[model samples]
Target: MSTSVPYFHHFQKDTTGIERPVRFTFPFCYDPHELSILAAEQVQTYLAGQNDFIHNFGLMDGQEGLVIGKMFGVLVVQDQEGNLGFLAAVSGKMAGSNKHRYFVPPIFDMLDPEGFFLREEEHINQINRNIELLQKSAELKELRENLVQCKKHEEQILSERRKLHKKNKAERKERRIAQQPCLPEQAYQELLEDLIKQSYRDQHHYDVQKEKSTQQIKLAEDALNHILDQIEELKSERRTRSSNLQNQLFDQYHFLNARKESKSVLAIFTESKNIQPPAGAGECAAPKLLQYAFNHQLTPICMAEFWWGSSPNLEVRKHKNYYPACRGKCEPILGHMLLGLNVDDNPMLENPAADKELEIIFEDEAIIVVNKPAEFLSVPGINVKDSVQTRIQNRYPEMDSPLIIHRLDMSTSGILVLAKSKDAHQFIQDQFIKHTVKKRYTALLDGLISGKEGLIDLPLRVDLDDRPRQVVCYEHGKPAQTKYKVVSIEGKNTRIHFFPLTGRTHQLRVHSAHQKGLNCAIIGDDLYGKRADRLHLHAAFIQFVHPLTKSLVQFEVKDPF
Candidate 1:
């Protein structure tokens, strides 16, 4: 196997060897030969000093990067001539170094002002501005005002007619009431005659008002329809123009992959079974590394990618964590690119021991408490069903009343509480809701914190694009609170105690990993920190009022680390 250390050198290629057509593809700016030669030294330094496999992160406090990132690198190999060079990449978006001396250039940079996409986009913007200006057209404004005036005039006439009708009704009621029980023949006759006259007058006035309203409304309707027709015509014209421009822009966008083959937007869709290009294609790290290699005729070796900076709100990402090329996007395109090249299997996607035995710590008729091992799932997942709930169902087939009430991260190992009866389950869960259940977690933070203890109040939301990864977002996030205290210092690593107030998903993990928060990812965190055998976070202690006995009961477990 080649050494983990990076080796970079120039591998000259003929510029006149292949001619590319005039097409708009992702812009890549880097001399493959020059980059390989330059980037290898940094790779070597990183592998030799940091990625020794013996030296892991989160062990010492006050270190540079506790949540160290994974690196996806390409070591372009050409064994025929005994020439060597390497290219480097980190997973996700790194804080700095996208414009590093050694990195490959982007496929398409829409940020350029001269770019056709940007120019076309400006056209679309101008079209929108025109549409807005059209809404304020004098012709349309006059039509609207005429309609409003017509409606107001009609309403005023109807209101006056209603008032006349009301007066006529009141007069009729008064005349009838006066002749109620014992009315003289002459008096009754007079009231009847008077009421008939008033009714006829009211009816005549109402009919005149209605006729006037109908005529005015018809005229207004005809006028309004003409204005509406004009508006719709204008909209249709704008839409057509916009659609034509969009098509032109799409036609102009051509993308190049690792094969150094350029294809238009339509061609790419026609080639693939998918209706559209997968999201965030061409821009990912894997494609960048591969494209750089293919352009220089460099052979593919092995590649690794790591993430840096804050995790996106949708996906599960941690700084310095290794992640495979996204399957949805990179797979189909890379499948075409890496057709005959002997590529290594991605280890990041492999799951060796998904199912493991559970160790029960304490059990009773009301509840059962167990010591959960790391790498074991708490509940059944969409893809994997080897969870604590599944295991319990398998172990206790005859007993099924209450179920798993709480959850722990699959990478976390510690005490877990389960209820045997529905009553106990509701009571226990209620305590959690009321914040009466006190829970304490122990974690080995990657960095040494300055303050011994403090509170972290940050809102968290799951990254929809990446499951199980949470991000700190104030606008759309759940309120999360965590109180932490430094337990002990092991070399540079600090053992800490966590008291979480809200049970948000990945609450503690996000809080610790976020820069504004603790900025210390738990040890062995694949998503947020350096990967190890297991995440160094455990639920150590839990105390709550007993449902059956009405007494406070507490449970504690020893730290595995």
Candidate 2:
């Protein structure tokens, strides 16, 4: 064959009688596995000094113009006329420009088909093909039909065989019974023999079953007796405990009522008797004596010791109070003589020896409110010591065990409520649990808040890693919300009026401190804020319907913040 002509590549198209320089480079289509280093080097050398441009030359749609690799080449003037000429010129110019600007040949790169990731893809493709083949296989289809047919046939054969076998066996048994010898005496003898044998067998079976049933009945009776005995024991124990508790309650009630009755004695000692006293003794009047008794919990020994001096020759004799006394009783005349007022009345009698006095802020038949001090906790905590609960316990010694419904923080100074009766307690507690109680608080945060009003909708939940610390977790947190409006902005502090929508511990404190971009907490909130002497938050108002009267009850405290 003649030597192949070196073709001229034209750079212009869509014009008549035009000639321009155009570049021509080798075009290649290769699978990743077909790539060779020599081919890569040749492409690189040829494309040196050329700008980069991508051209798709593939059978697949939407995949041709992707960057495959880069190469550089220069175009020499050529004579041609066609769209291909124009396209070649434009691509060559682009490639040259990239090469000149970037100082590197334009390389066309493509994903290698034989790469490990692509091989996995290929493996998946092959498996899919195998699955498709299996789905479309004629043998599988024919085998499935054959299996159905064979199963149906086997069922039919088995059914027919069973019927035939059953009929045959029944007929054979009947024929054997009919073929037996027939003689009256022999028949009777055989009948008698069978009857005797059946009777004996029946008796033996009955005896065994009867013995077993008798044992079972005995066991059942014993179990029932044991159950009855246990029930009796339980009843006896319950009766004993009930009697003991009732007796204790009775004794305690009598003792308290007796003290109340003794308070009348104090009144009698002061007003009715008109007993004149020495200097300053009028202060310890009968009411004062009764008040002291109420305060000191007037036990028999305490009452005797205070009234009568410790003299052995007082000639004391036992009377009404003797049985209550363990050993000796005070003489009535001696008690009366000692009970008369004096100017130098004992101050100890005026004020009881008790450590603290109960300050009852509000008291009614149903409810009681107490203004808790700063350091004391509102309710019993831990061992329930140094709390409002303990104070109430000592104050209301006449009441059965008192129940505390709600709590405030230890440092929080506000009106605390208690229910006197169980019914009232349940009513108030239900209102709280149902969120019918409206509570508001005033707090001072450490920074000047810009917003006049805003709502914090951030959710909160207990932090698992840190006890007592609440965390913000949008995806997995309980919904906690607080509505806050700025009341006043003073210096570096902002007073916020807060209405909590949810009752989570430390919700407002944590939200203010942990909010994004506005990380200012209430002053003196140690857990969520910088150290301060005391928290600047205060419970300013509490409102709820009264449990007993069903009247609207509202309480307010001056905001400390």
Number of the top lDDT candidate:
1
Candidate 2 structure quality by residue, lDDT tens digits, 291-347: 322333331111110111111111111111111111111111113323322212322
For residues 253-354, what per-residue lDDT tens digits would candidate 1 score against the true structure?
Answer: 455544567666546655775456544455577777766666666666545555543444434455444554555455555666665554444332333235
TM-score of each: 0.70, 0.37
Candidate maximizing TM-score: 1
The lDDT, on a scale of 0 to 1, for candidate 1 is 0.67
* lDDT of candidates 1 onward, in order: 0.67, 0.47
Error of 2 at 229 (Å): 56
Poorest 10 consecutive residues of model 2 by lDDT?
Answer: 319-328
